[model samples]
Target: MAQKSIRYNYFLNIFRIGFGILAGLFTMPYINRVIGVEGLGKVEYVNSIIAYFVLFSALGIPMYGIRETANRRDNLKEKSKLVIELLSILFVTSLVSYLIIFFVIINIHSLLDLKPLIVIMSSTIFFSNIGIEWFYQGIEDQRYITIRFIIVRIISLILLFLLVKEPKDYLNYGIIVVLSSVGGNIFNILYLKKHLSFKGFTIKDLNFKRHLKPILTIFVASISVSIYVQLDVLMLGSLKGSTSVGYYVMANKLIRFTIIFIVTLGSVLLPRLSYLISNDKEQYVVYVKKSLNYFLIIAFPFTVIFLTLAEDFTLLLGGQEFLPSIITMKILSPIIIIVSIAYFIGYLILYPQGKENIYTIAVIISAIISVIANFFLIPILGHIGAAIIAVSSELVGVLIMILLYYKELSKLELISVNILYYIIASFIMFLTIFFISYFNIDPLVNIVISSILGFLSFFLFLFIMKEEIFLSIVLDLKSRLNQN
Candidate 1:
């Protein structure tokens, strides 16, 4: 029954992520028109810088706390204790982050133009700490968090469409985004109290120092991960400038949201996987292989879309000025597969089992390679260079995970023939999309047609293959719903 509830919540969270993406999809074209390339680029550049401080404030607590809390969910007192302890650490690190941000703004010569937005965006660090989403996630209570996402995002979406009307309102757009994050996190506090109360809990309950070792280990791993996530944008902003950042971020605005739907499956499964690691190893292995197969099902087709409709997508979403993003999207599309598998290895398989060092090593080496590649590439190729390095770095990370976890993979039965099925399915979809593109119609109509045909092809292929993992999920979900 417990596992069934988690699965149902996972489905709900999937819808939440999908709807949130759709809302952003609705908002993006309008915002891109109002902000234009340079204005949007400037907003992204500052947010990229602020992303560092956000990581600092978060300090790996989200993952660490989730694992720790999930492991101790039976002990309400202990779960509450962990939340308080983690939040206390988040407060200190957030303060440090703010101090550092202030120092950076004062001393940095290049960031003067972005200073005000930098300060404005950095507010996420503080508000996000109060949000303590880690607290909600740790206890495996996704209901309210998903609800919070819908309410706040819809509100932000309304505010965005209503207020952001011109290029001059770029800062206003930034404010809306930042405040939405802050407000959402603030709302997290209310939902958190309902799940894990701290009525008798006091400072004495928190072993802040005890958490630092594990939390900081995860924090370092997170910093390494941030290399691919945030550093690429910062490097582009620094070496290539805001217009380049704008084009790259425009791809990110679409691609990252697409990634979210698949990735949240991993997020929803992590705590459950953690629970399985200690109590149900067989279940753990079964879940791992199935989830990964599901990812390949989704990732393959999305990569094809990016490659086939790159031009149409760029023209429609970002307007003609961002045609450069067409190439960037194509360069970066392979990451769809690379990141999904890598995330499975790093987060679902390793972190839940307390294999932080291996995970950290993989991310760190990838981060180092990313830094080297960006330094060498960003100056010459700009966003194109950044995109190439991002994809390559992710590929390298996935390879390292595969190599390092080969024995584990064999034990988990990770090698499945279903991979070939997924490829065949995706290839069929790609061929359909490729054929649809030859019509030479309007880009908008082309995207709509290609997407519909491509999705239908993928679905048909999955059905034809009788894909076991995909079908089991569908059947189980239906069975569970019917029982309810």
Candidate 2:
């Protein structure tokens, strides 16, 4: 299969990411009013529970599959066999996960009420195996993946609005959520023929054992990472009930929404980076450096914007019911930079370099600290505690990775002096937005205006300072226009 240019894939991913988030953002205010905090919290808590099942069923295969598939992209026969082998393993794992969840829901008296919601959401685990999105990522075929995601998400959004009309309709919301995920997978399964052929791969040709060790290593890392990420919601729900989960997840989802942009920027590099590690180490380092610089430029501004306008964002996006999330959002905003760095270090660098062990260790240690902290903190401090722990744990994980890879990191010079320009520009933008927020304007109008002016000032400053990355991008665009 022929691969598209990195720029092409990146834009497609960005369009899909932007569209999906915008759709959710468009619907959230209505949903928040209709469902209310407690109702949303109930759905979030149930979804978080089902997320664990999905994570286990996945078994790190998604991450592993991306690298393995990219490695074999030039060899269709090998790629087919590898994909089949991974899918076979995924099938058993998802089936087992479903059975286990079924037992938990049926046998636990407290969960009896949520059984229907849980059952609906749990189908996501099974369909996840069929989706094989990792396969698409590995081949760097963002066009198909992006289109399928946007279509399914759009359909789900329409269904959400149509079906979920009241607080009592949270179950309907849950069903739509499942359909969103499962629907995408249905397309994915059908679209496999574009790149992969199942022929000539007998059962005997499949080699699960060859892939087992690396898959398991990444699986362990994935589990640790999920525990670190998801445990907060679980603990918050358990200790403070669904209302608190709603507040926390509201804040979290906003941060994650911004993070999708940052993640997408670097994620397109993974298959290429995986390929480059063996074929061209020098080029790999160059991409990593450029990506890190771009991450900081994007992340710092996002962090500052959220930190400055948390109230406006919270009020606008989630409405008055989500006021508590304002502070939570502020606490979690810095993770934009932290996670961008961690993603660059872990997925782009460590996994591609065959250092899943190091990646695993960092997150495992962080997860341990998170679990311990969450236990002590959630009961007393509630969602605020969870937010604090989330930031700290991610920071710790990033520090560990940097510490472990200091020698190599020093060579790459991941931190650029240009980041200073980004910081100054962000501070200026922050002031611009902060000043705007003081005016007695409508929340929605104020935010729209503040965001425009803030980002405008940010770029104006970057242009004045002649930031290298910004200038480079400008010159590249100019060149492209001239060519056209």
Candidate 3:
């Protein structure tokens, strides 16, 4: 297999995420108006509930498998044995997860009403196991992953618009959402033979016990993270009814959509970092430093723009029915920076270094704080409280991660002086966009004009300042273009 440059992988990932944003821009407003808040809320409510089962079925394999597979990427025989063992484990966990989903739906009175939707969405659990996306990610196969995703996403979007014509069609919307999210996974098995094989691997060669401790450790951390992440939706549905969940979902989705760009580098580098940890420690450190710098440069600007233009974005994406989500979006805007720093530290640093136990501890503490805060806050403040807790909880997790690993993190010089440059540029960009907001214009047109001027002004200022990172990127793109 051929290896791609980090720049190439990053481009593919960005393209993939960019297409998703385009799809959402087209679909969200349509879905929001067609389904209305309560109807959309009902689908989200069930989706949130089903996400727990999906999380458990994963059993942390998504993270653990990628690291473990990258470690053996050069040795196909060993990789095959490892993947087989992990799949066997995954099969059992997924079966158990689905069974539990079935049991809960029948046993719980409230869920009975959602039984049909729950069952429809539950197909994701089975598809996830077959996806084996970890193997391709381990080998850094960005081309296949990106292509498959775009194809499935396009199909899913077409289906969503066609089938989900009204509020009552929310069930159709639920199934379409599930397919859009995980449908690409179904193609993974078809592509497996080129990279993975079970030929020389015997059942007895598998050592499931060897993986249990680490997998369980990561699994616990995942559960903790989900508490603060997914539990807000679940709790909102339980306390304030599905309508509140709907509002929070809109804001949360919008915020998370932007976060995909911030975290794209981390996802691309996870396998690379895992590989470098054992083979090239010096380059690994360099990549970590560069990764953090890149994260901050993008995160700062994105946070400022989103904060200033939250209303335009909410109106543009979700329309007037979701106007309430604008405040939530503003409150959650800073999460782009928070999550960027945390992702670099946790996924790029600790997990690759086999320090997930430490990562687990950080998130567990954050989860405890989040749960206590949500219980007291959600009833009084509703979606706003959830938004506040979401930011604070993530901030707490990142703080603990930094504090616990301060001695190690300090030596890397993750905080670059270029941060000052990025901050100044973002400030200039914010002024540009903020000024544009006062002019009378259509929301979509305002966003277009604001984004164009804002980014041009941003880069114009950075160029004037002669920022090293920006210059390096410009030179790198020029070099690539010249070579081509």
Candidate 4:
């Protein structure tokens, strides 16, 4: 039953992430065509500006909430109290963040034109509190999250096509962007009634005092992390203009999209790992090992494929006019593995163990590196420079985290023979795809064929090398077939 539940969480997130990426890939070119490069850039620019506010509104509640809620899931009253208190805190903080946003928009001379879109985008802050995404995540009841986000995204996608018909419909497109996230948040609020009663809970029951310090600590860490993240788009928009922002956004989007497959595992596993740490160290160790192995098996190939087929991927996803993103995507591709490693180290380990200070230090230093690098590079290389800084900074942060937590991390013995198998598989797959693509064909067709052939070769190499993940999947399939 436990295994089944864990698999359920993993696969639902897989469905949501997979669906979101596939849907975006299908719709992006059309959306870009309608919006125009500059228009798309403007949209990305505004969204990037709003992301900081969104981050501030979020603070550390999501992570902190997940841990606290998961620990208290059995006691309905305690869980309810945590939810209300966290929501109250979230509400107050989001309002404060929104006020800051309002002030910035009004005071900044360049942002006046985007005042409307910025306001509309800011609606997400309000929804962020009501969403209580942490509550559901804590319980590992991701079916609701999966269904809600997937349904909302699909609706937004349809609305995007129907309403956003031209470049002038940038505002309409902006509405779709807000709907993508906020729509589900509304559902999350409505869903809360089924689980807990707000009417019975008073403000007196909410304990905001206890959570304040840790939450703020995580918030500062979040801000530092967001610095490097949103800095790319913000700098591009400010220094290089909207067209450059557009190209950079596309590349960043592609990298993020590809990362879903890798990161989703670590994300869904966090709560379980936290629980297992005290009660089941053996399982926890196994999960850590498996996460690392799966990250290599899963993330490595996607990065390699992106690196090798950057041009083809850009043309397929962004159209010919935005081919400048090809280089950015290539430069950013390898970060996939790095990001997975960072999450495994920072989130799965240090975070669950209450090492937020060390985590914060690592990310803050990383953000500083990003800022300095961007100052030097964005002016000279533009968006490509942003890509380089983002990747390099993450690498630095991961290294710092490893160094700080050397005693704990070293015991895990993350290096293994499976890693060599993954590398061998990925290398062989890359060669196969490279040779096949030499035929000179349609970009889309080339991508499709290369991915299929490359993945097949990857699987073949894994099987030959007896990779654990591949063997486990094969065995699981056999078990299911026999049961059927």
Candidate 5:
């Protein structure tokens, strides 16, 4: 049953990623046409502000709920009660936070032109706090959540095509996002209702105090994560301007989109890692090592590709008007590699051991460095400086978490020959792309040919290095195709 669940989660993730990529592809041109650069920057800034408040509103309830419900999965009554309790807490907190944010927006109406749009989009925060979908995640029922998102995203795409006709119709774009959020959550809530009975759920019997410590720890960690991740856009918008914010956000979106494969893999591995850590230490260590190895194999080549083709990708994705973000994208590309490694170290290793404080502290330190870097850098280097600070802080944070994880594990097998082979293979792939680009080929053709060669070299290197994960996946696919 667990194996089947894992397999289902894997396929669901593939579908989700495919859908996300398609959505991005569809939305990018429309957004670029409708909002233009400055307008897109304004929209991103407003959304970022609301996202920070949403993080506060969430207060780590989803993480707490997922952990507790997964731990108590066999106990239906207890799991349901825990879900109810967490939902109630999230509800109250979201309401209060929304009120405060709305009040502030109303009071500061003159300074911000998009207060109405922010207010409309803020409903996503309240709706998402209901926590029905997370219950599915805890029990490994990802198909439902996956289907819900897919349907909503399809609807969002249609709405974008229909409503987003002009550049100044930013308010309509805001509406599209809100509608998608509400529609998706509604579907998730309805879908989840079939699996668990919420009939007897009540807030009166819940005890928040029992889970206060871990909840607070996760809350602080969430805020810290948000600081380095989301706060940069807000800071860029404030310090530089919306035009710069648009460029930075566009670059970030492209880099982050490329890492979705890693992110999906990590999501699948996290629950498995949590289970292994609870049940089998030796297996947990093996799982962590394998996961990290797979990440390195996938992430390293993509990092090199992004660094090489940053300018072409930016021009293709966001147009020539977004040339300013090319440097930003280059600076931020390596972050995917580093952050993927850190996520494995932190979540799979340190987090399950109750060493979440270390993760929180690392993020806090990174956030501090980011703020200082941005303060000095954004004024001089503009968006590119902000991007540099963003990636630098991420690299530093990952280093800190890795050291902490190693200390907790009491050994370091991270520098093994396997990792060395992965690094060498990545370097070879980089050189392959570099040689392909050295010829005075057309830029677009160079990118296509280089990407093909890079991946071909990566697979050849993996074969030579005998990477088990790569080999296994290849053999499995080959066998399945033969059967078909």
Candidate 6:
């Protein structure tokens, strides 16, 4: 069962990466040509604000749902009962969220001029909160989730090409997002239907009081995570202009793609880790060490490449108008690497131990630091300042979390070998890129060549270090190919 989950996760990661690349390639030109940097920034700012509301609407149900389902996996009837109860909770929460957004929009309508767009986009929150995919995630049904995402992306790309015409078409873009999100939810619902009948499901069996404490804790934790994650763009728009917001957002989006890859790995490991931690502490430690080692190995080299190629990547994806964000991208790349590790450790190691309050406190501290940084930085440095603030705040948060994690789980060892390998590989990759770029090569070509060399050098370093995680991955792939 564990092996199946791992394989499923591997496939989903590949699917997600491919989908991201295609979506980026197709949508970048459309967005850049139509809305331009400033327009894109405005959209991003609004979306970021909406994202917080979305997080509120979610109330961390997905996390709670997965944990519940995993714990009750042996009893199908109990699992179904839990699912029905969770779905009921989400339904009420989502409706309340929708109403809150409506009232907020109505009250701030004159100030923000976000009436129709916010109204249309609010449906996404409700649809996404239906908790359909939570079941699949709990059972490790990655194939279904991956297929649904791929189809949604493909259809959304078609809509973008067919409908989006000019800068003013931002309204249409928002509508398309709402529509695509609904379509994805519908697919998830149908997929869920195939696994269980909702005919006899009821809320009567739910242990609401028993779960209330944990649910509220998860909610607070989710809000804290959302604040640090989404508040920067919101604050950036308010402090600086939307165009400045847009440049920083574009850079942040690209960095987020990197973080998504790492998060995918974390998502795959979390349920298993949660289950293992309850049953076998020693085994859980082994899994945590293995997962963290893998994360460092993959994330360090990518961070180096992102820092090296930030300028070229920004220019290629967002065009010359967004050239100012080059520095922002470079500054934030390493932060994403750190954030990826922090997220993995928090979800898989800390939260499962019922230490969500510690995680929440860490995120709150980071949020406060982020708010301060943005207040000071935006006036002077603009979007670049936003990026700097983001990176610094995340670093501070992760450092605190690491200390807390050690305090909570004193048995877990920080593997010095993993840290040493990552640092050495990152240094080598950074130097390789520096030399390549210093030779007066064309920026685009230099980025490509440097990226190739950086990747190769990183992998070679890992190989020389005899990293068991990398070796295990290699052997697994070879064995799968041989079987095929």
Model 4 spans with C-alpha error above 4 angstroms: 1-4, 197-202
TM-score of each: 0.96, 0.97, 0.98, 0.97, 0.94, 0.93
TM-score of 1: 0.96
Task: Evaluate model 3: give its lDDT.
Answer: 0.89
Per-residue accuracy of model 1 over 1-484 as CA lDDT, tens digit each: 1334666777788888888778877778888888998999889888887888888789889889778888888877888888777877777888889899989889988888788888788888888888877656766667777788888888898889788999989988999989766678877776666667777777766777888788889989999989888898988878888899988988876788767778887888888888899999988887888778877888888998888998988888889889889889988888888889888889889998888878888889999999998999999999899899988888888888778877877778777778988888888998999888778999889988999989889877777788787787778879989999
Question: Any idea what lDDT model 1 has?
Answer: 0.83
Q: What is candidate 5's local distance difference test score?
A: 0.77
Tens digit of per-residue lDDT, candidate 4, span 168-265:
99988888888886757888877786776556677777778999898888888888888988899999999999999999988888888877767776
| Candidate no. 4 TM-score | 0.97
**Pairs with steric clashes in candidate 1:** none
Could you give candidate 6's per-residue lDDT for residues 1-484 as a string of tens digits?
Answer: 3336565686776677767665775577668768787667766766786787777777767788777777776666777777777777778878887778777876874435767667777767767776366677777777777777778778888888788888888877887777655558876765675566555545575665666677788888778777767877887788777888888877888788778777877787777777787898888888888778777877888788888888877777777888888898888888767887788767887777778788878888888888777788878998788788888877887888888767655567755676887899899989888888778776668777888898888878878988777778789889999999
lDDT of each candidate versus the true structure: 0.83, 0.87, 0.89, 0.85, 0.77, 0.76
The better-scoring model by lDDT among 3 and 4 is 3
Clashes of 4: 0
- Model 2: per-residue Cα lDDT over 31-137, one tens digit each: 88898898888888888898888888888898898888889999989998888888989899988998899789878897888888888888788788898988989
- Single out the weakest 10-residue window by summed lDDT for candidate 3: 257-266
Candidate 4: clashing pairs of residues: none
Best of the two (2, 3) by lDDT: 3
Better of 3 and 6 by TM-score: 3
Q: Which of the predicted structures, 3 or 4, would earn the higher TM-score when compared with the native?
A: 3
Candidate 6 overall lDDT versus native? 0.76
lDDT of 3 at 99: 84
